[model samples]
Target: MSGHGEAQPMKSRKSGPLRGVAEVPGDKSISHRSLIFGAMAVGETRITGLLEGQDVLDTAKAMRAFGATVTRLGEGAWTVNGVGVGGFREPEDVIDCGNSGTGVRLIMGTMATAPITATFTGDASLRKRPMGRVTDPLALFGARAYGRQGGRLPMTVVGAANPVPVRYALPVASAQVKSAVLLAGLNAPGETVVIEKEPTRDHSERMLLGFGARLSVEKTGEGHVITLTGQPELRPQTVAVPRDPSSAAFPVCAALIVEGSDITVPGVSQNLTRNGLYLTLVEMGAEIDFLNPREEGGEPVADLRVRFSGEMKGIEVPPERAPSMIDEYPVLSVVAAFATGKTVMRGVKELRVKESDRIDAMARGLEACGVRIEEDEDTLIVHGMGPGGVPGGATCATHIDHRIAMSFLVCGLAAKAEIAVDDGSPIQTSFPVFLPLMNGLGASLTAG
Candidate 1:
């Protein structure tokens, strides 16, 4: 994906009313899971509304490498013919997940108990992320791994010849880590038990049930206990992926900050575990209408009507809410920059290990744009100067992370001067249509 040229720095300026309908791409999490679970099932799985981003596409290619038949039928429509449980063939080529930690980690777990070996690699940003969180739990199912000294990638995974299930209590609240262990449990001998003190996204658990696997969750005094029966015949499914709330955050935050703007984002996921940013926006005095709330393919969906407001005031985001909005803190910080007071976000040490240390990336970039920010290992505090008060003349280095690149671009759309990102090329890894969508909504974005 780094093939996207970096010579083209992206710039954005103060915008007019951002009016348009934005249909962001499919959920990256669901897109990767649908293809992965499909590849492990017994029959053909047809998927619609798939995110065609490089991250998910790299996952699709990995499925093919494991001897599954994957094909693209049309835009957002894909076919996956699975190899069934415990039937994976050893891949001849290495799997390059291309900047997707989710894709590489989850795929490693999917093949962990299948008596096969595969090596995984990714782009520069992803290579620096810690894979030990995933590889640690996977080893419990008898899988073995050898990578860089710090457990970084260009790694080799050897699947278990005979896996025995074990009960695990999550050390960190990460959907990727939780899902990796569960996927590895697929071919283990007995029931696999996972206990989480705090809840993360449950797409893997929900999809397992939908695909005819025996799974159950019970909330007890300790935590949420998830039990999965291993070695079941995984049935294929017709998956209709929901639009991503993460991608929708860009437009929704943009409309809130730009003066006199009113915009609607259609068919976005409203799952409680993923809507923390929207809820925080409402608390900050945003007038967003969740029109026509309904369910699509077993997930909550809604049309978001966002209107620009200059009266927004920042509020403290509690530690308990961090897991739900972890991926959103970068852009949420941008929204806070345009609000009227201080926005405090804590319990996000997890942000330190993302594609980049997001707190460091945003704090430095925001300071460069003449906005005040405070940060530590677990908290990010943005001191807002109100809408149109920010003097945005600085150019930000994206650190090759998509969220960092997009957050600064949104900052430029309301600041007194233009904001520039050193490289917008990484934006394609998630929301490929970001620029066109922003431009369509009346934002001033120039590609150099």
Candidate 2:
């Protein structure tokens, strides 16, 4: 595996507090959904501020393969002319989703209820992630999937000819799984219901409704109960995707941990389902506040004013909030190292099967940097070293995971010594301007 490509090492040195405005790109989840929904709509869908990340780009390509006329107009602007509901054409070639689990899983769900046969594959890191969670639920819609051992990638999905709607209770807090089933239900008859034991990001549900799909969401004792009516003529509409809070976490955390730093990240999605990390950080006494709370693209958003907080105290993150902040645990762990006391994250076993074994990767990397941590199958406990107490002479192993590489780079800012990572190229998957943005904020990151 090491010989497949030349390894690049990058190092980061201690820096003063990060200060400036961070205008992060659009939300990744929403960007992906916009393309998928646009492809299934009856007319042209125009989108602005779309995240031009590799993951979202892969979804755009998949939409084009399904006969949608996807066109890039300019920076952060795209248009998709749909083939209408139940009008997807059978692709003659494989659907390669690259390194995006979201792209593959959600696309698989969308194609499952149709009468098409498609094969899915991805990069080395994405292929290692589990697909069983998606395939198991999709089987209820009369779809058939066959994959390698352990439900790894390079799989073929045979869609349902006569699909049946299903009511599924999510075993884990995953927006991708929920979105997949919901997308599959668009071509099926009758109503499809999904119950979440814990709330995840609701971008899929909200965007479906925005595109004129018949979708409703209600809070129930069991969890969030979502219902979708099938075979509706989805009318396309213009979409303005908000800045991703998950991507915003990197710069926000860096500013909070670094000394004498103050920054503002504008137009961040503050959707209640996705602000759990910022809430946890505020509870830990970080100097974060919302400015100009407003609505955009039918979602709640805010401009976050973050400043350096040296007296952060760690706190237990409620397990119920996992779905809202699932993609942020890696950056949260980096921030935790600078806090006092212990930060405990529970009910996150799903982290084990992401692009990398996130729990193991974070635990090992933190330990290597002279911070203490304990982990199990579903929980991670970090004994924070307080502000500026981290001894960071270690070179962290990123294991080809983008978040891991970025997280370690954030840790090096307030650490006593410099920190290094095995590779930094994967950061382009989501935040391509990460290093330049951080460097502009006075971070000393160097490529070797």
Candidate 3:
């Protein structure tokens, strides 16, 4: 099983103006997919700039457990020698995916039609997250899943001996669920179609095509129609991942509120599906420039130049945009605390099921920091005090969620007093270099 280990509590103090360029790790979404898709290809797939966080590394281990030969050539460089479709071998022991929902969920789909029975478990966080979302779609492919109450983790997936392709419409806007179904369809017969009323991240669709799978996506009145032909011979190719825009939210928001701060984030993924946070920030009066727009790995990539801007006014985030920036609301809430008026975010009930109840988590932490916040089942309203109006000096519990931890640390960058997170260890799961990267940019941080 994956280890949670001891909690490491850390504190952050109010910092001076932050300046410098930040190069965050590769996109976590793309990293997990790269390892999984690479493991599913016929020949060796070499990858550069893969995120080496625990979540992604666990995916790499899970790929190996399923019989792929994955090797780390050096830092951020790995190679996967795949065993194509329907070629996975059932593991002798349980597969522990640690804190990665993406790792375990996608891996479950990978094995759902391989005539294998694989038991999947994760850390406390992942085990608590509902697995029914992914399993329900896999069931259409003749996969059976038996797990704890409420279809949570410590679950076992019994693959279909004679799998058939399925056409599933996504019930929710979840990239994980969408990706899981597409992966299970790989070994199923015939074409698998998935229609999502709301578009989620298209990494799976993009990566599948890049790996030599025959797939097509079209937008109709209903939503996005994605069709994939199963059992194709996937060929390996080199992959270069772009920097994660999600992780860049921290520094970008910190610079926006720190007064006179300016920062640069280079080579970030500008894929429309994943750039919602940047769009939301811009809506909140952020001055961010998309520099040197170019294409890398078939996805749009750009450099972001952001500067301190205190004239930001709160704006209601259109609910439809939530799917694109779902992972960024926590930090976006921090930015809202510095803006004028209320920032209303709707269509975000998805925040409730993340690593933690993020809406509740951020609401409590922000209120403790003397910021006014109103939250219900599906919306979070953060009343901004504008710059220099936030009161700090609260010890916030991160709920073992990486976003909550990082969001609060960014809060301290502009708060009047020091802010502390109960544990900083969770940051390792996604952005292991977060601390040094922030400090190098002139933000003062001290470990506890």
* Sliding window of 10 residues with minimal summed lDDT for model 2: 1-10
lDDT of 1 at 224: 90
Candidate 3: C-alpha RMSD after superposition? 0.8
TM-score of 3: 0.99
- What is the TM-score of each predicted model, taking all chains together? 0.99, 0.97, 0.99
Global lDDT scores for all candidate models: 0.92, 0.90, 0.92
lDDT of each residue in 346-407, candidate 2, tens digit only? 98888888889999999999999999999999999999998899999999999878899999
lDDT of 2 at 115: 92
lDDT of 1 by residue, 395-418 (tens): 998888899999999999999988
Candidate 1's displacement at residue 365, Å, is 0.5
Runs of candidate 1 with Cα error greater than 4 angstroms are: 1-7
- Error (Å) of candidate 1 at residue 177 is 0.4
> What TM-score does prediction 2 earn?
0.97
List RMSD in Å for every model shown: 1.0, 1.8, 0.8
